[model samples]
Target: MIGILILAVLAGGCRGGSDSGDSRDSGHRPAGGMMDEGTAGQLPKDGKYDPVITLTYLRPWGPDVKFQEGEDQDNNGHTRWAKDKLGIQLKNLWISPSTNNAFETKLRLSLASDAEMPDIISYRGDFNLVRELIESGKFLDAGELFDQYASDTWKDAVEEDPTVWYPYMQDGKRIGIPILDYAYNSDPVMWIREDWMMKFGFQAPKTLSDLEIIMEAFTNQDPDGNGEKDTYGLTFGFKNWVNTWMSDAGWVFGAYGTMPNQWNLTEEGKLEYGSISPGAKQALEKLQSWMGKGYLAEMAGWYDEAKAVEEFTAGRAGIVVGPHWMPAWPLADVKQKVKGARIRAYPIPSGEDGRAGRHGTSIANGVILINKDMEHPEAFFTYQNYLFDHFANPEVGSEFENGLAGENEEAIADEGDQLTNNAVHTEGYDSEKYTVTFDGARIPSLNMATLLKLAYGGKAVTPFEKKVKSGASREMLEAAEIVMVQRNIAMNQMFTGPPTETMNMNNDILSRMEKDTFSQIIYGKISIDYFDTFVEKWKAAGGDQITREVNEWYRTVNEGQ
Candidate 1:
């Protein structure tokens, strides 16, 4: 559910999200503007190929991906877009699962069976799979095509961090383009019921001991005032899943100075899995103890994130951990699910030394690969660069497309006759909508401040901001502000080293073994001391090899620098 993360601009400041103190009068604005109606040097715009370029693709969709009734894989908005606007026709070679693991499995099976891969393929963050795909030599080295077709707007945005290209770089060439998601967007924060805390006359939990007491009160003191033993102190889904961006207990490990789902640099300057450390052992022990005391659900480990959110929605759990966007999602659901439920976000609590270090991912690790046989790699750049022009690039033409008179910068939309950026269309492509929903790459600096400002007062900054402001509750608006203010403070992993050879062969087994051990310990199925044995097995099972490769990568990168 990584909704359109409207970056530093809204879907307008003259164009959209990148990072900000949104001063319309600020010296900073989208660069390179002032256009004549027709420039001789300007190349052909992205739309309606006369001969029509047809692209075959594999669909890796999520459960949330929906079409407007009668519309589906080939005939829906984006595919129709191929036939209509981009002069490209899209063909789905196969549609993979919207469920977790299903799509990857199907994709893996396709690779194994040597099924013909599509022209364009989008994948989630599976570095090993991507590495294998590139190694198979069935894909294009997109470097040359990218440079030729990428628009100035897209080029400028990418300049913010060229290293985003790291994950897909093979033998010094970009084998595929990296799909960019917000980096700190997955960073965990402690979300608690400030309303519940106030009701119980409790202070914010500043340390581990304080948290225990708060959980105690939440479990037993009836914070909901229902006078029943129905509520729990703190709850998150560690049930059937491990760490994810939402409904996760990763912060439980963070409380002990590490987190699951990442690698950390050791004092000796080597990389190590954060989940296998002493910090993890202690964290699991504490969670087991808390479960014993009835501070969490007995089956808490089985709950996927959404079910865990239902606990809060149903007025049962008091605290949850996730990134900033929770307010827009499961938290907001609390209102529809229960009239009195209230929630707020806080900085993830401190460890013994006051370090509340949380984990983060790289900006552009999920992948976009072009097939080697595709004639026009530039087609992707054309369509996506057009997405940059209307949706992401708030400064491309130097106006916000704002409805207000100088309240927000008046945006200059591309004003192309064929289409706007909207995804949904009506009337057999005769069209009722003004834009299209093309997902891939984003403005790296998309800031939240101006969007919040839109909520506080004045005209909307961007149409995107306007919709966001209209939809947000006061709680959401406030939570967004807190997340934005504290985002820079997060401790990013800063490691995009692809899976090493041993890692590629052993990651699934190792990851499963790790999650099983952690889960069993938290559910009191094993002693905390079993972690020592688990660590031994892990090292014996190629963890050592992974460490060696990661260090080599670290050394190579640093030496080059």
Candidate 2:
């Protein structure tokens, strides 16, 4: 049995695999799941234990993670701090690179063989794998543990959205503790060429009709000089789903009051698939009209998000729909290509009802699981609570104001006046990733709010605000303000659970059909009436059953709330 366990652990280790002795015993107590009453009574109230207990976890690290010389993953500044401050020694049962499915494949091997599990499991990918882990019953009830040991700050963060725990709940028990992230990170804002709009004397678009006028000008006026009607008004990827992270067109469907590629709550108090809603037909008609008028890029049906961005950056397209962070990357490059080019983000234009809707993000980006056979469940929370209380948003001039990597005094002095420099010490070390949660603690609103405030001439009083103000450009701050101003209009996907049995079998076919039909309609290759036929065919092709299963899961989770 020991030989089999060793083989399983070694096979799962895609690179740099290490086993720090047996997971069953860590010299704390008898090899059992929970601490005995006597052991609990003996623990210190200062959030630290005596003699230092080892806490093992299985996780994957990014390939770009770096450490200072002579500081390895298992023996870093974070590990030493945890040991010194919390009396909890952190160890990895096995480590793997995050690329090429290496960590996931390793985890599956361990699960398949029923090998010894770690004290904590840090996972951030695939709700299906989370479901498998829960069903295996090798983990503890994290909700209960959180309630008992979590700090008030941590609990408040989790309670901000109770739905953040939905995907990890099963049979009335919350099996995983959510890793919180910032909200509205992927919410859409219209990114337009300010130069073109100014040249045409167009004001900021407040409604769909107003936007159409600008689109017409961009398409017809040859906004880029030396162009012979070669440019289009807008470009977005449609080869994949219309709703995507970058170069998106979800807001077009949103203008008609339905969002494609997500599940939305209907007025009947049940979840319905958005793609089949009546509003989808109206949105398709508009898209078809745009295609016919040459307002959209030619051959857009074959472009993905990156491909679509090329059209906008190459001065061939004047507008794109994406998140506020565009100014940092591809949008910034546009200035280098076209002289005097100015880009800015604006709130997406509303429909006739004077409301706009775009995709909303879930606050929880990952999950942390605890082992049922672990010796110290509360210790995990003790360590994390410290992270949330101190490192998540440190105060100005505090011990952790510059983060665990420390501050660079030279960088601070050099760019302090401009307030657009990152003064954090990131020279070959990123100790935050070494935390048990993998990315440490985070508050969802701190990042964007800081940028918005800084952009609007707010003073940077706190360390987090100073960090954000130092890094963000004028364009980024302006974009972030627009994002926060329109936060209420974003719509979150209603269904967050793992795929149902029917979905597991039929989703690929349905997704392919949906994408193909939408692309064909936008390209004017098919009649707009064909959308009605597509919707009918979709219901017949397991969409109805998927809806039933989705609503059933929804009711099961929300029961007696």
Candidate 3:
């Protein structure tokens, strides 16, 4: 229907919503999107679309998204909020379960079959798939459109880290609007069972050799005291690669002054493949030796993140490494598994030179791609700017400072009420703003930045940190404390060069080779010196060409930047 649509949205729990879409309150007034003849052909920055526009969108999450009593994904507070505020109603193009990679997997079928796709899609994971989508010639160039319609608020957000757009830019044309997330979410930390360390009378490790000593102790000291050798010193998944977001092994090389699966700048200012650095050779030899000494879990190579975390949850692994939030899920399960099990967080160990490196992703989460043929490119920007003002970065007295002023306004402020769980209010408000980048979201306030400031500042805890501490087991609190310290010293990779031409064509083959070779060297299937041969083979198989192109792109994107 072209008429306005408004749906009732209920509220949810008192805790901050999911990491994706949290921290939204409410606003007043139904706004406009399009303009009338008296105003010529133009859209209002803060009003509803004059001609109600329905956008076809793909929903990645199924019932995983909480909704109010009368609201579904397609007819919820979020949809109603958009319609009333921007006159942009979202039609559910299709819904796919995000779990187990189902969403992307199904979308790929459409992409390959030339099936009709949605007008707008917000995707995360498998960036290569995103690149494929762009090259499909189905998306619009968003640069000029953005420059013409982006609000000052949205502009400031992008300027915070402009490189976020570099990946979606093709041939100087910005084909995508980047979805941004917290910078520190991907930082690495070492998660060890503090009870085990205390039981063994071992202190936290400071250097690589100290880590080796602790690992040896964890393996042989019977820290679990079950009178059976059923535990491992360390556990992490290496099925995909040696590095990952969680359960990562990249820090091992970082301790030796390198990070595999990244490009590092040489003293000569040339881009050097991290895997070929001398530090990687030493780290691989160390891992091989550790494997021989029975310090590594036997299932490490075969495990994915879910499976890798099981050993730790099941109380068979003493150490796991990942980002600061590990205690929220897989580690949380550990408390249920072992009555006294205490997981604590620490910084990844450093080398003798006191340098450390960790695997990381770019600040951007995903991008918003629009259909090239869509006539309402400016419509998308108008909607996004509205979101930026009201939900993403609401100023106290702005038009959208309050959530959409519809039927639910009375219920939105009732935080104490337990009935409502509508998305306009309950939806992970934080993650979603970024989800619709083209229309538009922010770096949320969560990343523990405030908690860190309070913990180190010696001031009384704020309500948020107090909640972070409430009912938290002493061990969990201590882990959070340690994370506050780790945040300061962690190093993220600076180079995020776009995929080179050679990379786009040969990356699969090359990545497989490197994975196989690296795993072999660590597993003792290949000698340490084989890494040298693998390096040459990789360079010959297009690594060198990719390197040159990547350098050129880096130089270009960063010109005068």
> What TM-score goes with each of the models?
0.81, 0.84, 0.82
- Candidate 3 ranges beyond 4 A from true positions: 1-46, 66-71, 99-101, 393-440, 444-448, 457-495
* Candidate 2, number of clashes: 2
- Could you tell me how far off, in angstroms, the CA of residue 409 lies in candidate 2 after the best superposition? 8.0
Off by over 4 Å in 1: 1-48, 77-84, 100-102, 125-128, 240-242, 394-441, 447-459
Displacement of residue 27 (Cα, Å) in model 2 is 23
Q: What TM-score does candidate 1 reach?
A: 0.81
Q: Where's the lowest-lDDT run of ten residues in candidate 1?
A: 25-34
Best by TM-score: 2
Q: State the lDDT of candidate 1 residue by residue for 310-410, as single tens digits.
A: 78777788888787668777777776776666787776677677766666645664677889977655556656665565445343233323321112222
> Cα deviation of 119 in candidate 2 (Å)?
2.5
lDDT of each residue in 1-561, candidate 2, tens digit only: 212222342233211101222321221332222445855654565546776788899878887578668977798878988787778899999889889889889898999999999999988886678888988999989998887666655766676677888788877689999899765667879999999998988899998889999999899988987768888898997877788889998898888888898999888889988888888888888888998998998778889898999888888899999977788767887898988888988889988887688888787888999999987677787678767666676644544666654443223533444222322345536667777776688766556656655666766656666666666778777777787677767778999876788998999899888988988888888998999899888989999999999999889877857
| lDDT of each residue in 79-133, candidate 3, tens digit only | 7767776678877688777788898889889999998877777776678878888
- Supply candidate 1's per-residue lDDT for 229: 87
The order of the candidates by lDDT, greatest first, is: 2, 3, 1
lDDT of each: 0.64, 0.77, 0.65
